[model samples]
Target: MATTGGARPYRPTLRAMSVVTFNVSGVEPVQGTFDDLGTPLHEVTFVVFDLETTGGSAREHAITEIGAVKVRGGERLGELATLVDPGTPIPPFITVLTGITDAMVTAAPKIASVLPTFLEFIRGAVLVAHNAPFDVGFLKAACAELGYPPPANPVVDTADLARRMLTRDETPDCKLATLARVFRTPNQPCHRALADARATVDVLHALLERAGAFGVHTLEELTAFARAPSPQQQRKRHLAEAVPRAPGVYVFEDARGEPLYVGKSANLRNRVRSYFTAAETRPRIREMIGIAERVRPIVCATALEAEVRELRLIAAAKPRYNRRSRFPERVVWLKLTDEPFPRLAIVREVKDDGCAYLGPFGGTRAADDARTAIHEAVPLRRCSERIGVRTRRPACALAGLGRCGAPCEGRETPEAYARHVTAARRAMTEDAGIVYAAVKARMDRLAAEQRYEEAAVDRDRLAVFVRVAARMQRLAALTRIPQLVAAAPGADGGWDVHVIRHGRLAAAGVMPRGAHPVPYVEALVATAETVVPGPGPTPAASAEETECILRWLETPGVRLAQVDGSWSLPVNGAGRLLARIELAYQGRDERPAREGRPLR
Candidate 1:
C-alpha cells in the first residue's frame, strides 16, 4: 500500500465482500414496491440505513462504513453492513468518537465500488435514516463523483418523524440515543453504521405504532404524518382518499353541500391530499379545509377542460374562497352614451340604448385609462350633468380650457356636438386612427423637445388605449356572430370543441380520440345551455366568460369549424393601432440615452 500526505491510498481488497443479506429471527425480507396510496403501511418495505463518515460534512468527507436493515410488518427482513476505504485519512477526533480507526478500513473496498452494492440492497425500498439528509447527502456526493446519477428513492428521516410523533415528556429530544432509550430498542446506537441503522429501525416501528392512532394506515399517510398533524386535517384525511388520480376539478363543499372552494389540478388525488399536509400554507385554505365536510371530484379528459370547468364552477357556485370571477357582472365598461353630447362614461351594466360599448374591462382602472385617453384626444363633453338640447346650463372650467366641446353651454350646436360624438364613437368601436394619430403626434413633439418623462407617460397611456381598442374590436366582431363553433386539438389526443352563442360559451365538450366530431358537435350544440339575455341591455355572456372564450379562440392551433353569422374584423379595425403602440414602446428603456434622436 502507498501513502500520500499521511493518508493511505485506496486499495482494492482481494476478499471483496458483496452486500450481505440475512433474515432476523427467520423472517425473510420482502421486496419493496411502488408507493401506492392504497397499499397498507404494514405491507410496505422500509430500508432503515445509517452511515459512519470521516467528518461531519458530506462534501468535505468520505464514508467509512454503511449499515442498513430491511423490515416489513414489524418483522426484520434483511440486514447489510460494510466498511468503505475512504480515500482520505479519518480524523483522530472522528476515530475516537465513532471507534472506527484508519486500520479498520485499510483494505476495505472504496466507496465507488461499495456504493453500487449498497444501492442494490436498498432498491425498491423506502430509505430510512436517523437524520436522512446526512447519509443521503454523502451517498449523493459519492454517486456524483463516480459520474453516476443518484437513486430516485423516497426517503424518511426518523428524527423528523420522532419530532412529530413523540411528546417532549416522553423523549425530551429526537436524538437517536434518546429515542433508543425511550423505545427500549434491543440495539443501542454506538456511533457505528450498523448499530445506528438497527436503532433507527426500532425507532421507526415505535413511530408507526404511535401514528396508527391518527388513522395513518398507508405509506402516503405515514409520510404525511411527519408534519405536525392538525386535528382538523387528521379528521378529514378520508375526504381525499376517494378522489381519483386523474386530471379534474375538485370542489370543497360544506356540510350543507354549498361549495367552499373550487380548484383545478392535473392530479385530483395528489392535489386534494396536499391540503392535509404542512405544505398548504394559505391561511384561508386552512380555514376552508377546517369547515369542509365533503370533497367532490369531476374528472376531465384534459387539463384545459379542467381549467374551463373550474372557471364555470367558480362563477356558478360563487365559492367563498374563490376571489376571481365571482361577480362577472361587476366588470366595468367604457360606454359612449346615446345622448347629444355622448360623453365617455364608465358603466357596469351594458344596455341596448343604441350606445357604443367598448369593454368588459377587468377593472375600473383600465377602463378609466381608456376613458382618459379618448377624452384627451377627442373634445367630448367632460361634464356629468344631464343637459338636454333645449336646456341651457353654465359651462364648467373644462370648457374654458378647451378640454370639452361645452355642449351644456350651447357653445357647440347639436349637429356639431353630434360630429364630435361620432368621431369618439368611431375611435372606440370602429377605427382608432384619429386618437392614435393625435397621441402619437403629441408623443413625438414631446420627445423631440427632450421631454422624455412626459413622453414615456403619454406613450404608456397610448399603449393602454390601443390594447383596449384592439380587444374591444375583437370582442365586437365575435359578438356579431349569432353562432360559432371552434375546435382545437387537445393534449390528450382529442379535439376540444366549444360552441359560442351570442358571444358566450353555450356548450363545451371534448371529441373523443380517433372519433368523428360531426355527430358529437351537432348533439352538443342542440343540448347546449341556453343563456338568455336579461331584459336590461346586458350581454348574455359575462366579461370573464367572454375573455376565456376569446383566449381559447386565439390559441395558435385553434380552427373555426363553423360560423352561423359573419365573423370578421373590420378593414380599418384597431389591429393596426396595436402595431403602432408596439412600435412606439419598442426599446423604450434605451430612449433616455438616445434622447433628442428621431424615433424610427
Candidate 2:
C-alpha cells in the first residue's frame, strides 16, 4: 500500500548503541553562524537528497521518487519521502531496475503537487547528494517547467567529496554502494530513495572527518579544498587576514614596502583572498603575489570614490603590475611652434611658449593624426629645419607637392605663411570647423564615387581630430577660470566638494553627513592655495588630472557652487563640429556634393 503522509517525522536513532534525539520541522531553518573562514561544517544545515527517475537525461526523463534527510549539527532534523507520478507511462525496464511498478505510482501524487512541499522542506539548507548533478538537474528542470526559478542553494556532491577526501586504497570506486560499505553506514543499498538517502547521511559525516585533518573545518574551506593551495599561497595566507570587508582599494607591496600592484574591490577581504586560490590564472598576478609581503587596504565611502582613488594611486605609485595611466607626465601634446611659420609639432612637455597647444594625448599617434588632419586642410610648413627671418634654406620636397607653403625657402612670405598658421591654430584651439569641413568634403566625395574604404579612412581621421580638439578646448576654458567650486551629493547624505584654481584641483574633501555644505565650502576655499597662471605653453593641469576633473563635473547630479571666472564654450567652438562629423560619418551630408569627380 502507498503511504499518504506529506513528510516523515524525525525519529530517534541509535549510533554505536547510544540513542540520539532529533528535531523535525518544515519551516525555514535558522541561519548558522559564520566566522572568517565561513560557516563551520557542524553548524551548517544540510539536506541530503537522492532522486529516482525514468532515465539518465534530465530533459528526457521524469522523476519517479524523491528522498531527503535534513540534518544540522550532527542531528537529523526531518525526512521527506514521496513517490511522484511522472504523468507518463513507466517503462518495463525501469520497473525491473527500481521495482517501482506502474500500479504502485497510479495512486501517487503528480510531480507538480509534490515539488512545492520538497522545496519548502529544504529551504535555508545546503543541498547534498551522491553525484549531485543528476538529482539537481532534474529538480531544476521541473522548476523551469513550472515557471519558477531553480533553488539557489549551494550544493555538495559526495562523489566529488570522496575523490578529494579518500584515497583509492580506502575506496576502490566512488559509487554510492561502494562508499556505503567503506563508511559502514547503518542502512544498506536497496535501490530505494529513502534507503539511499539515509545511507548518504553517514557517508557525509565520514568525509567531513577526513576533511578536518586537512584544516577544512568550514563549509567555504571544504568547497575550495579541491583546488589545493601551493606552499607559497599557504605561507602568504596571513596577508589577506587583516583586510576589512568593505569597498576600497588594495595595494600589494613587496619587502621594500614598494607597491607592486593596486586593485579595487567592493569587498576587500574576499577579493584579496581570491588571489591565494587556484582560480587565479594570470601569471603576472601570481608572480606579484609571490613577491608580496603585505597587503594594504584603503576603505572608501562609495564605489565611485574607490575608482577615483584607484586612478590617483596608480598615477602616483606607478606600480609594476599596473599597465595603464602609469605615467601621466609622459602623455604627449600637440604644439603649434611659437614662430612666424608656426608648424604643428608633437611635444612631450608643455611649455609656457606663446604658441597654441592642442592636446595631452595618451600617445604620439593621436597627436600625429590631428596634425595630419590640420596639414591636409591648411598648407602650413612641413619641413623640420629651423628657419630664421633671414636665414636662407632650400625648399623641401613638400613644397613642390603643394602640401606645404614652404616658409623655409621663403617661397611663401612670412605674412602669407602667418595666415596659414593662424588658420591652423584656430582649427586646433578655438574652432575645428575649418579642418572638419575639409575632411567631410573629401569623405562625401569618396562616398559619392562608391569608394567606401577610402571614405572610412578619412572619417576616422576626422574623428580623432574632432575629439582631441573638443577636449583641448574644454580644458582651456576651464583653465581660464581663476577660481571655481563644485559640489555633488555623496554617499551617506554628505557632500563631495572640489575646489579648482585655474583648472588644477586646489582642494578636495567631503562635508560630514547632516552638516550644511555652505560653511564647509567657504572654509575649503579659504584654505585653498592660490595657483597663479603660468606664462608657459603647458596648461596648468596635466591631461590625466583634467580628465579626472571633467569626469567628476559631468557626473549626473553635479552642481556648480561658485565661479569667479567664465565657464562657457565659444559660439563657434569645436564642440559644434562633433555633430557634423558624426552626421557625415553616418553617410548623411548636409552640404551639397562638389562638382569635381572624386579623387583616387
Best by TM-score: 1
- 1-600: candidate 1 lDDT, tens digit per residue: 111110222222224233344579888865533333345667778899999998888766789999989977677788999999986678899999999888999999998889888889989999999878888999899899898789888888888777656666787778999988887877899999999988888777777766666667677877766655556777898999999998899999999999999999989999999998787745468668889999999998656567778888998899999988787767788888877667888998777687888776778888887787787789988778777887687888888888877777678898988888889888887888777778778878887788876876766766778787787777667766778888998756888888887777777778889987788889989988786654222356655556667887888999988898687886777887676567765654333334522323
Candidate 2 all-Cα RMSD: 16.8
- For model 2, the run of ten residues with the poorest summed lDDT: 1-10
Clashing pairs in 1: 350-537, 351-537
Report lDDT (Cα) of residue 534, candidate 2: 74
TM-score of each: 0.58, 0.57
TM for candidate 1 is 0.58
Tens-digit lDDT track for model 2 on 73-140?
A: 66788999999887666788888988898888899999889989999988999999998889999999
Residue 23 of candidate 2: its Cα lDDT? 44
The backbone clash count of each candidate, in order, is 2, 6
